[model samples]
Target: MTPDATLAARVTVDLDALAANWRALDELSGGTASAVVKADAYGLGAARVAPALARAGARRFFVALPDEGAALRAVLGPGPEICILGGFAPADIAVFRDHALVPVLNSAAQARAWFAAMPGAPAGLQVDSGMNRLGMEADELAGLLPLPPSVGFVMSHLACADEPEHPLNARQLGDFRALTDGLGLPRSLAATGGILLGRAFRFDFTRPGVGIYGGAPFAESRPVVTLEVPVIQLRDVAPGEAVGYGATWTADRPARIATIAAGYADGILRAAGAGGLAAFHAGRRLPGAGRVSMDLITLDVTGCAEIGPGTMVEILGPSQGVDQLAAAAGTIGYEILTSLGSRYSRRYTGG
Candidate 1:
C-alpha cells in the first residue's frame, strides 16, 4: 500500500536515543557538545529533531548553509548559537545577521566580503587543518585576521578522526591546538569521531552531526533513527521465477516474496539489493530480492513463517547498521541519512 496522499507514513525517530546519544557525546567530549543539524537533520525531519535537541539542553547548533540556519532558527527559536559550516555568500549577509546566525569564515575573500557586507557581525573562523574543504589558509589567517573580538571561536575540520587511531588524528589535533591556543577564541575540533579519539581533541565545544541521529561515525553511540516499512504484498513464486523489474533473482525453490514501498527515489539505493538483508517479525532475516525500484523494493520471505501483509519490517537499527547499508550502496552514513526520501510517513518517539 502506498503512503496516504494526505498523511505521510510514520518514520519513527527515537528522541530518547537522540538525547542519550547527545549526553554520551557530551561526556565523551568532557561535557562540551554542540550539534550539527544540517540536511534536514540528515533527512530525519529536522523540524522535529532540532527542538528535541534543544529540550535536551543543547545550546549550540550547526548547519551547512545560510538557508538551513535560517530555517533552524525558525524551529529552534532564539538563545542558541547557530553556525553555518559553509562560508557566507554576500547574499546571506543580511539574512545571517537578522537571524542571529554566525558564519564560519572559510576564505580570505569570504572574510573580507562578510565584513564589508555586515560589519561587526558575530562570526566564527574555520581553519583548514587537513580537509582542504572549507576554511581559511594557515598562512592567510596570520596576515588577514585582526584577532578581533567579533570572532567567536577558531575551528578546524578533522579528516582522519573517523579511524580513531589514524596518525592524522594527532596531527590535526596538535595543529588545531597549536594554532588556536592563547588566541583568546573559544575552540572546537571534534566531530563525532574526534570525541572517540580521547579527550585531547575535545576543546571548548564538540559538534556532532551523525551520532546524535543514530548514524554511527563512532560505535560507542546508540541508534536514533529506525526505518521500519510495512509489508504490502506477499506472493508465492515457482522455481526460476525472476523477481522485480530487472529479473535479477531467480527462485531456486518455491519462494515467498514481499514488496515494500521504498526505493531508490526514497534514498534506498538500487545497489542495496546486492546481497543485503532485511529484518522482520521479531528479527527474521530476509534477503533483498531483485532490484530496488523507484517506489518499491522486494524481499525474499520464503523462510518467514506466519508473515504476511501489514507486518512491519525494519530496514535499519538493531538488526543492521547504516554503515553496512552504505557499504552495500557504495556510500556513507552521511549520504544515506541526507538522501532519505521524503515520502515516508514519520513518527517521533519520546520527548
Candidate 2:
C-alpha cells in the first residue's frame, strides 16, 4: 500500500500556464470563456485546475456528469456557475439542485424532467447541429423555442472545427444559428477548436477544454504538463540481445539501455511504444526498445548525453509533448492526459 520512497516519476502541472491558457482562449473567444473541467479537469486534477481557471476569470465551468459538477461546486463555492453537459434522469436532479449546478438540457425529456423537478432553476439548452452525438435533434428543438424563462444559454458543439475547412463547421454554425436565433440567450458554439475557427463561431460564450491543457488544434497554447519518469536501472546489451517483453527489440550493435519505472500501466500507451517513442534526458532523445511492459519500459540510451539509475527522464515536456505522444500512440492529446497514471506523484507549480 505504500509507494517507494525512491520513486521520482512525478506529473508536474504548471498552474501558471493553465491560467494563461484560459486567458489565451478567452481572448480568442471575444466573449466570456467557460472552462470545461470535466473528467477531473481531463485527469489533471479538477480540484486544482478549476480554481486556477476561476482565478483566470472563468465565470462558468462545464462538466460531463453530475458527480463532477458536485465536486466542482464544492471547489467553486457559490459564485462561478457549474453546468453539467450530460443531461440527468429524475433521480439525478436532487444532486443538481443541492449543488446549485446547472444542467444543459440535451433532450426534451431531460428538459421536461428538469423543469418538473425544479421549475424556476436555471438551465441551458444544447441543440444537435450535426454531430448527432448529444443534444436535441433539430425537429425536437423547434418545439421548445423561445425557451423557458430560466434558460440561461443555447449551445451546440462543432463536429469538424479542428479541420477548419470541414463543411460540417459551417453547416453546424448555420444550423445552430437557425435554431437559436432571436432567443437572446447566451450562445456558445466553440470549444478550443471552434475558438480557432474565427470570431463568428465565438457567439456569446465559449467553453474550451483540451487547449487549456496544452493540446493541439489550439497550437498557440503553452504546454501545461510535464511527465518525468525515473530510470530504475541501466545495463549494457550486446549485439543480437533483446530488451523488454516479447523480445521485440534487439540491439543490432552493442547498446546501453535504461529501464524506466513507468510503462503502459503508467499511461504511456503501448501503441506509442510500439511506434518507437523516446524519452528525454539532458536534451538527448532515447528511443524506447521492445515492448512497454505493465510497469516498466526499456529505452535505448546508447548515445544519450547523460543518464543513470535515479536520473529523471522526461516522457512529456518541451522535447516531447502530449500531442507528440498521442501521435506516436495513434490517439489524441485528451486521451494521453486523461490516461496519465495515478501512480505518479503529482506536483502542481505556479498558480
Candidate 3:
C-alpha cells in the first residue's frame, strides 16, 4: 500500500540524496568510505538504507551491536563487510561467525576472545584515542598481542572533530598515529566530522554516519529525510482560550490551531514544543502551540487557515531541516535522527 494513502504520519527517505552525501563525504575522505548503518541506519531503517548505501559504492558498513550486524547482513547479503562497534560477547560470537560479521575489538580480552573464537575470521581493532567511551585505552595497548592475519583495520574515534579547532582533534589524531603507525594495517580515525577535518584525520577509511543521513557537522550535505505529518483536526480559539496540556499557551487574540497525528511518541521531541517550533504547508509556516503530547502536536495555524484535516504539514523538510528542529529541541542531529519512531509509515524515494 502507498504511504500517503494512509492517514498515519510518514517519513520519506531520499536515497539519492543520501548517496550524494556519501559521495561528497567520500570525496572529502580521499580514502575508503564506510557507511555507518548502526542504530538501524540511525533509525531510518537498515533493511532499506543498507542496500541504498551498497548501491552507492559502500563496501563496508558499521553497526553498533552484534545483532544489528546480523540484521544488516540479512539485507546486504555476503559481499559487503559488516563491522560491529559494540564489541562482542562469548554468547553472541556464533552469530558473528554465522553472518561473517567482524567485531571491532575494543579491549585485549575482546581481541583474545575474537581471535580464539574465530582465528581465521576478519576483525578490526579500536584504540581509545581520546573518547575513552569504547576502544582500548593507550596504556592498555602495550600489552596487546600483534594483529592477527584476519585483522582488517585499526581504528580510533575523535571526540572533538566537530569543533574543528578543539585541541582533542589533533591530540586524538596524533595518538591514533602513534599507536597504529608503521603497523602496515589499514588505519581509520574519522567519522563525519573527522572527514571534514581533512586528510590528516582521514587515515585509510572514513565512516560517515549522520552526514550520509543528512545531518551536521556535514553542513554541505543535502537533506535526506522529509517527515510529513497529517493534520487530523483544526479549530478556532477565543482570545483568552488556552491550548493543549499544562495550559501553557493562551491566545492573546483569536487563533486557528491544528492538531497533527503524530507527537513525541513519534520522535517529535517534547522540548521542541516549548518555543519557535513550526510545521510547514505549501511553504507557509504553522507555529507550534503548547506542549507536545504523547501522540499529538498542536500548531498555531492562524496564518494557515486554509490548511485542514488530511492536509500534510511538513515537520522536517526544506522549510524545517532536521538540524533546525533539533536545535529547537535542545538536542543534536544524531539524537533527532536516531530517536525517529517506527509508528510513522516510511517511504523510500529516489534511487
lDDT of 1 at 311: 70
* Model 1 weakest 10-residue run by lDDT: 1-10
Rank candidates, TM-score, best first: 2, 3, 1
lDDT of 3 at 51: 95
Model 1 agreement with the true structure over 1-351: per-residue lDDT tens digits: 335322223467888888889888887877789888988888888798888888888998999989899999999888999989997898777779889999999888888888788778888899888777877767878877566678888899899877877888888877777767678888988889887777788888899888887776777668777787777789999998899887888999999998877788888888777746455557667778898888888888887876667777778777776787788887788887887777887788997
In TM-score terms, candidate 1 sits at 0.94
Off by over 4 Å in 3: 1-6
Ten-residue stretch with the least lDDT total in model 3: 1-10
TM-score of 3: 0.97
Q: In lDDT terms, how accurate is model 3?
A: 0.88
**Model 2, 1-351: lDDT tens per residue?**
124435558999999999999999998787479999989999899999999999889999999999999999888899899999997788987798899999999999889888889988999999899899999987777777657899988899999988999988999999999988887888999999999999899999899999999999889889899999888888999999988778889999999999989988989999987886888887888888988888998899897646767788899998998999999889999999999999999999999
Clash pairs detected, candidate 3 = none
lDDT of 1 at 124: 89
C-alpha local distance difference test of each model: 0.81, 0.89, 0.88
Distance from true location, Cα of 347 in model 3, Å:
0.7
